[model samples]
Target: MKKSVKILLIVLAIIAVIAFPIIGTYNNLVSLEQKVDAAQSNIDTQLQRRSDLIPNLVSTVKGYATQEKDIFTDIANARSKLAGASNVSDQATADGELSNALSRLLVVVEKYPDLKSNENFKDLSIQLEGTENRIAIARQDYNTAVTNYNTKRRRFPSNIVSSLLGFEEKPLYKASAGAQEVPKVDFTK
Candidate 1:
C-alpha cells in the first residue's frame, strides 16, 4: 500500500476500535436505565393497588369504630402524600408514612375484634399485605438495576462514555429516617 493509504487505513481502524465499544456501552446503559424505570413503575403499581384497597378497609373499620376518626384521617393524608410524590426519595418517604399510618389503623382494628374477624376486612388486609410484598420486591429490583447501571457507568472506559453522554446516576429506593423506629400503638385510649 502507498504511504497515504496506509495512514488512512490505520486511522479508520483506530476509529472503528474505539467506536464499537462506546456504542455497546451506550446501548447497555440505555437497557439498564429502562429496567430501572420499569421496576419503578412496578413499585408505583403496587402502591396504587394498596391505596385502592385502603378506602374499603377504612370503610369496613368505620362501621365498627366510628369514633376512631383520627386514624382514618391519618391514612387519608398519607395516601395523598404517596399519590403526590413525584420522585423516588419522595415516594420512599411518603411510603414510610403510609406504612406507619396503616400500622396505627391496624392497631385500631385490634380494639374491635369484630372488625378483625369481618370477612371484608380480612380480605382487604390480606390483599394489602400482598401488595406490600410486591412493592418490596419492586424496590429491590429497582435498586439492583440502579446498582448495575451505576457500577457500569463509573467503571474504566465506560465512565468516560457515560459522562460524555450525560448518563446520570439513578437514585435507589431507600427507607425514610422514621422507618427504623417502630410505630407506636397504644391500646389505652
Candidate 2:
C-alpha cells in the first residue's frame, strides 16, 4: 500500500472513533430530554383529570354542607389557578394549593355524616383519590427523568454534547411549603 493512502486511512479511522461517541452522546441526550418531556405531559394529563373531577366533587359536597361556603370558594380559586397555569412550576404551585383546599374540604366533610354516606359523593371521593395517586406517580416519573437527564448533562463527554445542544437542567416537582403539616381540625364548625 502507498504511504499516502495508509496515512489517509489512519486519519479517517481516528475521525470515526471520535465522531461515533459524540453522535451517540448527542442521541442519548435527545432521548433523555424526550423522556422528560413525555413524563411532564403525563403529569399534566393527571392534573387535568383531577381538575376535571373537582367541580363535580365540589357540587356534590356542596349539596350536603351548604354552610361551608369558604372551603368551596377556596377550591374554586385553586382550580382557577391550576387552569391558568402555563408551565411546570406554575402548575406545581397551583396543584399544591388545590390539594390543600381539597384537604380542608375533606375535613369539612367529616362533620357531615350524610355527605360521607351519599353514593355520589363517595364515588367522587374515590375518583379523586385515584387521580391523586396518578398525579403522584406522574410526578415521580418526571423527577426520575429529570434526575437522569441532569446527571447525564453534567457528566464529562455527555456534558459537552449537552451544552453544545443547549440542554439545561429541568426543575423537579417539589412538595408545597405547608404540605408536611397536618390540617388543624376544628370540630366546632
Candidate 3:
C-alpha cells in the first residue's frame, strides 16, 4: 500500500470510531424522548375519555337534583377549564379543579337515593371510575418516561451529545397545590 493511502485510511477509521457512538447516543435520546411523548398522549386520551363521560353523568344528576344549580355550574366550569388546558401545569391545575367539583357533585348525589339507584348514573359512575384509574396509570407512565429521558440526557457522555443535539429535559407531571385537601361540601345551603 502507498504511504498516503494508509494515512487516509487511518484517519477515516478514527472518524468512524468517534462518530458511531455519538450517533448511537443521539438515536437513544430520540427514542427516549419519543416514549415520553407517547406517554403524555396516553394521559391526554384518558383525560378526554373522562371528559366525554362527564356530561352524561351531569345530566343524570340534573334530572334528580334540579335545585342544585351551583354544583352543576361549578362542574361545567371546571370541565371547561380542563378542556382548555394547553400544557402539563395547566392540565394538572385544571384536573384538580375538576376533581374537586366532581367530589362535591358526588356528595350531592348522596342526598338523592333515586339518582344513585338509576342505571344510567350507576353505569356512568363505573365508567368514570375506570377512566380515572386509567388516567392515574398514564400519569405514572409519563413521569417514568420523563425521569428516564431526563436522567439519560444529564449523564456524562450522553449529556455532551444531548446538549449538542438540543435535547432539553422534560418536565414531570406534578399534582396541583391543595390537591391533598378534601373538598368542602356545604349541605346547609
Per-candidate local distance difference test:
0.91, 0.91, 0.93
Please identify model 3 stretches exceeding 4 Å from their true place: none
lDDT of 1 by residue, 41-148 (tens): 999998999999999999999999888787888899999999999899999999999999898888888888888889999999999889889989988998999999
Question: What are the root-mean-square deviations of the candidates from the true structure over C-alphas?
Answer: 1.3, 1.6, 1.1
Error of 1 at 112 (Å): 1.2
- Cα error, residue 135 of model 2, in Å, equals 0.9
TM-score, candidate number 3: 0.96
For residues 41-75, write the lDDT of model 2, one tens digit per residue.
99989999999999999999888888888888988
Q: Give the C-alpha lDDT of model 2.
A: 0.91
Which 10 consecutive positions of candidate 3 have the poorest summed lDDT?
A: 95-104
Pick the lDDT winner: 3
Provide the TM-score for each candidate, comma-separated: 0.95, 0.93, 0.96
Error of 2 at 184 (Å): 4.3
Identify the superior model by lDDT, candidate 2 or candidate 3. 3
* Displacement of the residue 187 alpha carbon in candidate 3, Å: 0.5
**Preferred candidate (TM-score higher): 2 or 3:** 3
Ranked by TM-score from best down, the candidates are 3, 1, 2
Worst 10 residues of 1 by lDDT: 180-189
